[model samples]
Target: MLKKLINIVVFVPLGVLLIILSVANRQTVTLALNPFEPSDSLLSVSAPFFVFLFLAVILGLVLGAAATWFTQAKYRRRARSEASEAVKWHREAEKQRSQAEKLATQASLPAPQG
Candidate 1:
């Protein structure tokens, strides 16, 4: 619940701002680009407004993934190292316990009196 509220608070204003800017700059912003040059044939392929928006979204996703990978790489290495150390310690503990049990058995055996 808290997460949803925070997202709304953060993104709602940003979305509204984008809408406002889009409306204000509609004339200045080119919604489509002609694939053919001015000297080329009359046939021209043009992209729509949504195409630009889609490209922007894809670019943001790529950048976000790159940033996350870079930041978490070190932590992933550290976690693996800690897990290996834990396994080493656990094996040593088991060895020590087995040795202690063997010693206890030896001590309990009847001894020849002098």
Candidate 2:
């Protein structure tokens, strides 16, 4: 469908770009976690530059998803309450409908002649 076409159009180019970047940035780099001791190997990780690039992208996506989920919690709660309210109303309507039908049948029945 259109979604697949859009994915192909968008992701194909992005994939190619990522591949190019990985190829161009094959040089190894070290990420130092110890701010006080920048040269401390114990708190550092070394990998290809593209590894860090991809990790950052993945981390950003995870954080963004979490933020979006947290922000939309109120809407989700409201939807749940609305759904329960609808169910309650529907049950009340059905009860009323059955009562009306019972009265209609009773009224339709012939009275015994005295």
Best by lDDT: 2
Model 2 per-residue lDDT tens digits across residues 14-103: 999999999999999999999999999999999999999999999999999999999999999999999999999999999999999999
Q: List, residue by residue over 2-114, the lDDT tens digit for candidate 1.
A: 99999999999988977875565444334324455543434543454555665798899999999999999999999999999999999999999999999999999999789
TM-score of each: 0.54, 0.92
Report the C-alpha displacement of residue 111, candidate 2, in angstroms.
Answer: 2.5
RMSD of 1: 5.3
Worst 10 residues of 1 by lDDT: 25-34
lDDT of each: 0.78, 0.99
What's the C-alpha lDDT at position 65 in model 1? 100
